[model samples]
Target chain A: MSDPAGVIAIGWPQLLLATGFMVVTGGITLALQLGVTKALWLGTLRTYLQLLALGLVLGWVFRLRQPLLVLAIIGVMTAVAAQTVVRRAPDAPRGSYVRAWAAMGLPALVITFAVTGLIVRVEPWYLPRYVIPIAGMVIGNSMNGVALALERTFADMDARENEILALTALGASPWEAARESVRTALRAGMIPSINTLSTVGIVFIPGMMAGQVLAGADPLVAAPYQIVVMLMVATADVLGSTLVVLLTFRRRFTPDGVFLEKGWRPHAR
Target chain B: MDVSGPSGSGKTTLLRTLARLMPGATGSLAVDGQRADTLAPQRWRALVALLPQKPAILPGDLRTNLVLPWRLKVERDVAEPGSEALLSALDEVGLGGLPLDRDATRLSVGQQARVALLRVVLTGPRVLLLDEPDAALDPESSSALAQALVRIAATGTAIVRVRHRESDGLAARRLVLTQGGRLTEAGP
Candidate 1:
């Protein structure tokens, strides 16, 4: 039996071994594509730097151990990230960032908090290890899913406005015109996540579970946490993406319910 | 009357501006005494549609091309009722016996123009704006199209037809467009 209370110092060797699979594949992909290789190198370096810097910032902040402060930081981080996602997506309607965050934030907060609170019996739920990492990961993925879902769905709305209008003339409501886009885009966004979900244990052990195990915790505890994370991911994606689409649609049409051309502007920017 | 006075006329521009796929347009547009921007152009647009000189036929099954316009809300959904009769209205145009299921995108250029015309007619719009509508037609198709336009006009539909050669034996008001976007009548 190990001392479950102790903190693990993750050495560089273990880190290399843990990340080797991803890094090797990324390098290979970059090597195969000429220009993409440069982008890959820069992106990898930037990501490494950001993670290191963020880890330091989070380490200092976590020492304070105030739950309210932690919650406030999470809110700020999510808000900033959500705004960036919207801004990067071209032809994203006005007020998309604010609206999508408001929609995604609700379900992510409620479900993650509920599951982690009741299921994981971490003494300080605000701990950097227990809640912060999990929240950061879950919320980050949720933001991406919501952005992709919203972007694709909005583009579809613009491109197919004529068909949608034709349906409207045939006495179908706005939602009916929107239903195909929403369904198709949301389903498309979920593909990667679903692949990850389905292949969790067999294809590769997810980082959280493997990390917990390597740190020498009981596999049982690590398993439950991994299960919880996957469930939270599904909930976040379904609820967050769907809400954004719904809210975006409300803005998609005119006062009398005409689908706006601006709704479909490709995120060329 | 459905005619353009001469070359360099604002006829195409006038039709395109109303269709609002035009560039460099700024002004108020009134339709049925209402604001232009307020209307669902894709839906009610066909009501005053301007068929392009070379109409674009989207790649898809013939049925998809034909029924695509009826899916708009302003033309079908918001109306009191009877919008459902739109599909059968295809027969009312010259496409009468052609398989209702032909690939529109693959239709020969001449056939595509006719299918496009059929699409406009099915919408049952109030006006027709044709831009060199017969430039791609065979003599037979040209004759057929001319007859179709006359019949559609008989329905009291407002027709704004543009062409290089002036139409004969039709009640028409000729307004030529000169260089620099000017509209003029055939010499006073």
Candidate 2:
């Protein structure tokens, strides 16, 4: 299915229906003197451009199911996801973007391979239909997890500086001193996934399952795929956040367990 | 030895530097003639402990907080004291018969201070660095704390304490920190 019939293609008329709502919202904001009209219009334009570019790229990439091409696509997505995480989490330590990249990229790659190769068992093991969507879900969730973990861990360390230093002063190693903060960060990072697990079926159909159903796939099949996606996403998120926090906490302290006093940064404060 | 100075005199900074808690501090500190920086932090801390003005108590029972540091991987190689030893240390700090399961965080500041003091004493460090050890204590508690320090000192644990009050340093060799971080012996 080189050209799988496009999924519920929305023509310009249908898009105009959505655009009309945004325009009305912007108009109301302007009339009320809220001054958000510019933001509304700009956001709409940016979203439209980004999604259009993504659709075009995906269309080209999906036609060629070559392993190298598939890997390259996933790599680019992971890089963008990592950069997004670093940008969103501005309070993280300096030079944390590289660590963020590894944290999100490694876990996403591993989870994508396990799902695509072991469970889903795609014929080429790099099917754009399966691998691309799964990679997007896993990497996207992992990036969010990494960002949350970094932000929370840094804040926790700052708030609990006394506790950390107390432990260190009593012979705790750097890792030992940061054990509590790491635990807190991991819990904070993973809560979204845990909440999703409980709310997946009853609350609302998730995006992947909804898209599959809209594309004319069987609900039963889409439901199972959704379950698989959820598990992979949670695993990637947990692993990514865990690694990022564990790696980053060490940088906050000296080898001798003394916390390196972080100078005041505008966002870090 | 006692360190006395006005506010912002760096007395607390000196104590922390000697304890190796402040990485930015530059100077050579020694314990038993051994260079402090040469020793591993775990080893150095085991030998020289600092009791900060406000001791941070973990979220656990008194017993757990007392033994928490020893439970770390770095301290795993050292032999931990038995419950009896811990109780003895508690008794030495006027906390005899205090329930082992009592929450450390819930203790009064005075009681928590003693517990923090007892925690370091239990480690049997060769030197104790104290920052206003009785700053929060009442008269009775302060006297008790003094006796505890005397007993620990009698055991050959050298103590260097920072004190804001003149009366607090009467028994020790007092060094006043002047305006420019200069150390001078207190006048008689």
Candidate 3:
């Protein structure tokens, strides 16, 4: 059955049919004694439940269409993303949650608004449908970037402690001593986005593009949106990673430019 | 001057502290009557350079390693040595035959130690902190390093050399670190 939007409706039967595919995969895993059988079933269950909950939440937000509610949801999403970043990078020093929040939130919000307001030209600019999805993608990608950067910077600093000390002893400032580590972290953070940009549409169809096509948008129209999504994701990733790295590297040194070895080491507790 | 002590006596820690590379170190330090606290850390480090025991070679050839200090903002106003000056500096350190294009990472431990020393020396520190500069060197290379240190000390730059051996014929005054970390004056 088709809805008024002319998109074919997917009912529980179709969803259950999809679950059958996962069941077949789970069966193979069990047959092979792959340890991931439990993970596969648990992940499949969570995906179904989480997406359904997201659909209900989005429906409620869209119906009310209040800007404040939209913003509150965005705030919650950003906070969760920030916490996820810190959690993923367990080696990051203490008090990184606030820094991660700022790093991920600021650029992601700015870019989301810029895209929705300027590029998509969504009316009222706070339309839940446009802002939430766009902000979700931006914050999600930015979170990944920030997490990778924090992890890489801490690991690199620990590994190259001697090199950093050598630099400082040569009259290099703290920034100068940590420069190589920062560069490596930024590269690590941005490389996935760079690869996505280069290989988009050829290696695989991105999720947003696939969704838009499945909803019956013109391929040409959907292509530009996907392009915008890819570009914005790349921009947000680089900016977030840069901010996190800059914020965190200084913590590796004292104000006097001495490399504090204990500062970057993962705490025993 | 030479700083000597048995192993585990905090000799390396002393040199690191003097160069202001130790964060836990506390006490007043002065250079040429100027207090260390009054100086920017970069400036303080430029005045007092430390050569760590392990040689750290940057990812480049010999020329890049030698010229690294000059590239730092703290050394911006200082003149970078020319190829001739760098060549001669290598010569002075008994690495006369090493090529400027030679990859620094490929150098022997002893050779890299000398290059590490040369890297710090090029910064023209007023106080040089060497942590066992001769630890990896052969007798011939060690002697060359001693001569170089003597010449550098003659230029009025206070040199602090940490040595495991009793004699290098370079120190006019010596200090010894006891097991308890007390420093005592010893006759040269």
Candidate 4:
């Protein structure tokens, strides 16, 4: 009874259902005199425009599977992700952008290669349809982990300056001095992944699995892909955040093992 | 030697700099004729230690807090202190008979101060920089600390103490750190 050719297509009239819901939410906010009505309208408009642009660009990219184009796309995505991490983590130490880039890009690239080449084995390995989405997922999640780790680690150090100073006075290396904060930051970074892992199936269906099922794939087949993707995401998040925290912590201290008193403010450049 | 200054003066900062724990400090620092920055940071800190006004008692039993310096690779030159040595150190600082396994974080300020000093003594630094080390001590504990300082000094270790009160007969020379950041001898 289901058409197995492809997914059910969404047209403009059908898209009105989502638009109507957004209007209703915005209307309610206006009626309640909440200041967020403008924000709601603006956010919805932005999302619609952004997604439309992305759809057009992706359509063009999906047709061109050249490796150079794919690499360029990944490079831009990684640069944007690194910038986002720096912006979100206000307390992150100075000169953290480069470290953020490496933290986000390295593990994401590795995992993307492993998932595409080893696991999914997509033809050409640079097929935009497969690689773009997978790399986006990896980079986006790793970016979040890096942001959480940087913020949490710096906040902890600020709160426990005396404690860290005591360790420094007692001949502890900067790494040793900040060990507690590092552990806490790493745990904080991994929390989202851990939560997603624990709640994936029972609480709610994940987007990828739902998308695959709606596209007429067997639920059983879609489930395995979701499991694999989730595992890869968790691994990328942990590894990326760990490396980010370790590298960033080193930058927080001078070579003489002193905690930088200015406390990792971003450089003017 | 004694370093006395007003509340806002930079006595603590100077001691931390001397211990090579403050990076932005501008000056040359040499420990035992070797440039402080030239030596490995961990090694320099082991040789030149600082005891702050409020020392952090790490989350563990008292014994673990005392032996943490020994656990670090930088302190490999000093063999791990046995329980006998630890008890002797504690007794020398007037904190004898306390259980080694008791949670250190719960100790009173005075007791914690003694434990912190005992830790520095166990490490056997060539120079000890103490910031208000006896601020929380009672007369008996203060006397005990003074005696411990004498013993540590007897081993040819240099001691720099920061105090607000009059010199307690321990310092060889007294320099009052003025509000202007100048160190003027206490006596006119």
In TM-score terms, candidate 4 sits at 0.94
Q: For residues A1-269, could you state the per-residue lDDT of candidate 1 as single tens digits?
A: 33556546767787678667667867788777645656766776787799899888788877878888778776876787678668655666777888777876777677757766787766677665566776776777777777788888877777776555534433345686678788877886677677778989998998888988888779898998898898888778778788878887756665434466652433433
Q: What ranking emerges by TM-score with the best candidate at the front?
A: 4, 3, 2, 1
How do the residues A111-170 of candidate 4 rate in per-residue lDDT, one tens digit apiece? 998999999999888889999999988887667777888788888877778888888888
Task: Show the lowest summed lDDT stretch of 10 residues, model 3 chain A.
Answer: A260-269
**TM-score-better candidate, 2 vs 4:** 4
User: What is the C-alpha DockQ of each candidate?
Assistant: 0.12, 0.69, 0.72, 0.73
Quality of model 4 by C-alpha lDDT: 0.85
Error of 1 at B147 (Å): 2.0
Q: Which prediction has the highest TM-score against the true structure?
A: 4
Q: How do the residues A2-71 of candidate 3 rate in per-residue lDDT, one tens digit apiece?
A: 8766689889899899999998999999999989999999999999899999999999999899999988
Task: For model 3, name the residue pairs that clash.
Answer: none
Which ranking of candidates, highest lDDT first? 3, 4, 2, 1
Q: Taking the tens digit of each residue's C-alpha lDDT, what string does model 1 give over B1-188? A: 54464555577767766665444567877667777777664554645666667665656765666666654444442232232443444444445555645666677787778777766655566777777778998877777777777878887777777777755555467656777667656532
Measured over the true interface residues after superposition, the C-alpha RMSD of each candidate is 6.9, 1.8, 1.5, 1.5
User: Which CAPRI level is candidate 4?
Assistant: medium
Q: What is the TM-score of chain B alone in each candidate?
A: 0.78, 0.91, 0.95, 0.94
Candidate No. with top lDDT: 3
